[model samples]
Target: MTATEFIKKVFFFEVLQGLALTFKHMVSPAVTRQYPTEKREPVPGSRGLHALVRDTETGKEKCVGCGLCAAMCPSQCIHIYTSEGEDHKKVVDRYEIEVLRCVFCALCVEACPFGAVALSEVFEYSGYTREEFYYTKEMLLENWDKNMAGEKGRIYFEKFWRPKTVDFGAPALVKTEERKTV
Candidate 1:
């Protein structure tokens, strides 16, 4: 081999090539998320807020009150109770989630064999009361209505489809019922 080739092997062109790539990327737009204020919604199938999705068509809980989710909870945040349904099927009487303790690890949702449990896209859910945070079956269902308003809104397209701009741009104002009324 040539002495120049031997010198390059000893000096390492690979390190220089890697540094070039790093410098090239240093000027590019960043994808890092600024949490809480500038949030990114999870794509479908991402594990987030664990919930037992009801059969909207039947207006019933998808869960059969099966104990699999409870059994699988790493943090022991889940509790289940069963009752007889109108169709004589096992029904979810209570599906209590202790939010303070839940790690949001999503094991309970994965453990559910019925495809009943789903992790919602919800990323903001802070509450003042312990009672407010300790979600019941009713609360999670209600959360779908409360949080999904933006996802289903007509203005979603206008907001979402816009090209990303400067990082320091002013934050969008929150929409309220009072604002709409006026």
Candidate 2:
């Protein structure tokens, strides 16, 4: 190719093209809001974190200790022990999720047959210690309440909730109290 032609393609169009596109987005409506002050709704089914749902009807832990979520977890951040319960269902003994290792893949949520687990929109969890990063059932439930607050986020979580093949689904409440032996 001629020198001028190459310059136009490389410097003028090709290299500068990316900058132009970026500039366009800068002028267009922003997709992100400033953190804390301005929060945007999470896309439905956002795999932000792992949470065992609380059964609304019973106001208790919905997790039946099925191990489906644990089986589906790719990161293996989930740790659950099971025991016999009132209905002979496997009860969760100590449901612990290592937040530092969680990938937010939504696989566990989808794997739950009873819709007892989910990926919550509460993406704000951070920690200075490994101990702090490991979330217990209580911590997960608190995140659920915080994230599920307000109508907009709640609606967004509801609509976007869809993980397939027992790998993803919708957001679930961590409100239930009946959990494992813990």
Candidate 3:
């Protein structure tokens, strides 16, 4: 072995270097968050909990009982029941999401043509029992209500409502005047 290599091994240079680094970091500002007390802000477009959007004018849910969300769910955790109402409109009889089985892929949000379903930024949901995780329509609506209750909630909702510009490379799908005539 070279003289420098032998000297490094004999002096335990690597161990000393590691210790020096540890001591240096010990004096540095702590990066640890106090969690419950000091919660970090969720980034834009962050998907956490699920919620059902309500119509601003009528104060009614935007969901039209379309099962597109359930159909597009990869995990099949969404359950939606629809029936014809007295007003001749499809009524959402039941809407349930099994949170435990959900993969949080946000497919349901993307599939909802009416922008009814949205993933909220509230990720602190935890329960002692498995049954507690099963969120019903009322529970989901309540979640949305809680989110939209404050100014922060309004900002969050606005972020979701803002039009997003995404380009999916399928020119044939784009409807033009020529295509409309054809």
Per-candidate RMSD, Å: 13.7, 10.1, 8.5
What clash pairs does model 1 have? none
- Candidate 3: tens digits of C-alpha lDDT, residues 1-182: 99999999999999999999999999999999999999887764578888887767777777888798999999999999989989798999899999999999998877777767878878898989999999999888888887744464444444444313322233334255543342
TM-score, model 2 to reference: 0.61
TM for every model, in the order presented, reads: 0.56, 0.61, 0.77
| Deviation of model 3 at 179, angstroms | 32
Task: Name model 2 segments beyond 4 Å from true.
Answer: 1-40, 149-182
TM-score of 3: 0.77
Scanning candidate 1 in windows of ten residues, the lowest lDDT window is 157-166
lDDT string, candidate 2, 16-66, tens digits: 878989999999997776889988765555577765565556766767676
- Give Cα distance to truth, residue 71, candidate 2, Å: 1.0
lDDT (CA) per prediction: 0.65, 0.67, 0.78
Pick the winner on TM-score between candidates 1 and 3: 3
Lowest lDDT block of 10, candidate 2 = 173-182
Q: State residue 67's C-alpha deviation in candidate 3, in Å.
A: 0.5
**How well does candidate 2 score on lDDT at residue 59?**
68
